[model samples]
Target: MPPETPPRIFAPDRRAAVRRRMLNLQQAPDAPRYLLDDMIEDVVERLAFLRHRPQRALLVGDIHGSLQAALEATGAQVTTVEPALGFQEEAPYPFSGFDLVASLGTLDTVNDLPGALIHCRQALEPGGLFIASFPAAGSLPVLRSVMLAADADRPAARIHPLVDVRAGAQLLQRTGFTDPVADARHLAVAFRSFGREIADLRAQGLTNVLADAGPPLGKAALERAIDAFSAASKDGRTVERFEILTLSGWRR
Candidate 1:
């Protein structure tokens, strides 16, 4: 008898396609997630950087940007919940016994950001640090402007609705993370075309959070948006700027 042949394989899923398209809007990957992850790792190597050796740590939320930073702050021996690798689906225990708890950029995305912070507080030992970073209110002004100018009839996107330096600090304090501190860094991302900027934004998992993202762009709107973006360009490149805020506090 002849062996049976397998059926044809399909391409990617529609949901995946949507995700990919949506992710393309941001000019960069979640900055707090990526950058802080590196910071964690690098901070670990130097003894002076440690301030104190962290035997155990908890990295709250899922932001690849800050993974390395968390790692650096917390040594390899340190146990981390929602561990970096294969950690997406895993939400380990509260880790209330940990010496340190670093949130990176998780809180902002939560529906109840304050509640999440409270949970972080509960998950740490007394006086343990709880650090985080989130896209500031000042982020993505240029992109927002272009979109708004292009589609005057439609409502603007709710792209960046998180804390800036002031709001982050206040939230930390309000959430009972004592001695809260916050700072921001303005990073400008330049793109050759508006399409590229939108694509990069999506790749970075940062894009319009508008309740109604609105219907598919009409030809006129697309052309208008492109024109507006082109006008915003400098030195032959369109620019999208973001002000990322890093915030931290300690459990009292």
Candidate 2:
């Protein structure tokens, strides 16, 4: 057997963070997490526009279960890989069986993203479709700026490294997927306060998970970062831009 793959970037504890945050969202549906889910739904809607409805569908990383319900509404049987229940450690992966596989905000934090894409492709039948959307390169520049300003003297690794649009397409093709297409869409999430934005990030399970992250910001630094973020606001409100990159392909 090959040696265990060492994590390159994201911390192992991030898996636990993902589990906890997602569970809280399910238990309390008060936050506007659905707005973000719109990005994932857009990928599916693109497939639907092509009339690529599936008879058997799989949804990986469903944050609120709404995506699964929406897919089922089209009369497709759906299987959701809920993070809180664990990462399908015991489920059988029947190769070439699923007609469609869609994932939402899942790939960004994963350690073995390439292997994950391979698995996703393997699970698809001949000519089946796979679409995944995650935070890619050119995302969250404003947050990075704030993090740097917070610690201009000693910066801790606050953000995880992410893939960009072109690199994203290469991975799909490298995984032996066909006709790979990738694109980026911009979203400017408005926030009245930096703290509320942090809360929203927590609500969506998007937080610092770098394996080599130095340490959490000191109280003073944290306060300074918050101030910096707020100060960068336009017209008394902060607008954070996120480049939602979507990658799509079909099995050859």
Candidate 3:
């Protein structure tokens, strides 16, 4: 029988190893959740421009866990790239000029939304279409209220640094895309319990706001949060509202 070999230990430092482990603990699954599917479906319904077979299409979206929608939006022949979260890569521009490029609710979370749009425009053919959806800065007041009540001494959560519709249109125009326009899609639903709402957010990759002020939540804080949310609920359920802004332009 051959001699057994010991496992290799490659970590250079204990602190570095601990940091990596913590990152792994924070890492979440890259799959869509139940209600998030409905949210994406609703967005797809509004994307009427995706009816035909463009010579080439580029799909850009910040679907941390909503990869299903991203996969469905891009065609089988289409070359896709996500550039963030798990699948990070710059797309090889597939055509001399792409016929269309789209980012559905992804740009808002990016460090440079305008830069991404400019990159998309440069990749497209003249007269090519650019379509995107992003949550407006004005979304989810009800949830914000609950967060405020629970964490009174703490700063409010900025879940996503979303762009307003006007600014989003300006970004598209600034990228040298023409006839930029913006529209809104408001999603409203009621959850029976606050826990369900939080679960949905987790599944959607919407809960990882990095600015929590307190230490890891203790039992009392959690109970207070639940109570705050329950009291905020209207009638029998808490109303969850998401205001999404859809924008489009043409490469001129």
Candidate 4:
């Protein structure tokens, strides 16, 4: 029997559009970059701590260009594939033979995440390192509650589903990676209004890319959501939490 097809939960075109929007926004002086910066810092630290120096590196979905710069600074030749340039994570990579593969903030929306992970593993040379960081489960509790309140009797799918650390570890193991490791970290940001929080999500390409996302909320629902968000705030600001999951493994 043929292999089963992965469910089409995310829209590839929507993913590309959001990523392109993010790339455009990142060129502005006041773009929100905390999430990407935090992920990049963690990846760099992991590389340093592991003492694994890559002579050639492949970077996936690095919107800010900081990861490429850092890898180049380490004397590693970096090749970047960006969503803005029509790079699809679920598709087969055109090149291989890299000692390091670092994917940032893009894996969560792929429909065939396991296939994508397998592709990354296949692209690596023997003993190559693969590291990926993305928003994990348990993120955005405040926003989730507000969205639910907005929908009232009918809760809409406003947020994309996320993978947890345990699932990430299992994926690495299933994809033929050795010494797989998975961990999570939380980052909290205070938002004075719901609009500001939405803006941050848009700037980071963290907005909903689900294929079946519900229509825009009506004005009354929007107002209710805003009010609910405000009601949950403390000190005139609502604190939203993001759980970032990082997965690392070595190609045996």
Which candidate achieves the best TM-score against the true structure? 4
Give the alpha carbon lDDT tens digit for every residue of 93-166 in model 2: 55448989887887777677778788888888888899888777877787889889988888878877888888
Ten residues in sequence with the least summed lDDT for candidate 4? 83-92
Off by over 4 Å in 3: 1-53, 62-76, 84-96, 156-158, 209-215
lDDT for predicted candidate 3 compared with the true structure: 0.59
lDDT of 3 by residue, 24-129 (tens): 4335564334333544564455444445345576665433335333435565234455533333212334444776676654455444455557777778788777
Task: Show the lowest summed lDDT stretch of 10 residues, model 3.
Answer: 6-15
Q: Rank the candidates by TM-score, best first.
A: 4, 2, 1, 3
Whole-model lDDT values for every prediction? 0.58, 0.78, 0.59, 0.93
Scored by lDDT, model 1 comes in at 0.58
Q: Candidate 4: which pairs clash? A: none
Which stretches of model 4 miss by more than 4 angstroms?
A: none
- TM-scores for all candidates? 0.72, 0.91, 0.71, 0.98
**Candidates 1 and 2 compared by TM-score, better number:** 2
Where's the lowest-lDDT run of ten residues in candidate 1? 6-15
Output the number of the lDDT-best candidate. Answer: 4
What's model 4's lDDT at 250? Answer: 93
Candidate 1 local lDDT, 6-68, one digit each (tens)? 222211232234334433333354422333433344334332444755666766443333453
- lDDT per residue as tens, model 4, 1-252: 999999999998888899888888888999999999999999999999999999999999787679999989979999999866878677778999999999999899999999999999989999899999999999999999999999999999899899999999999999889999999999999999999999999999999899999989999999999999999999999999999999999998
| Candidate 1 Cα RMSD (Å) | 11.1
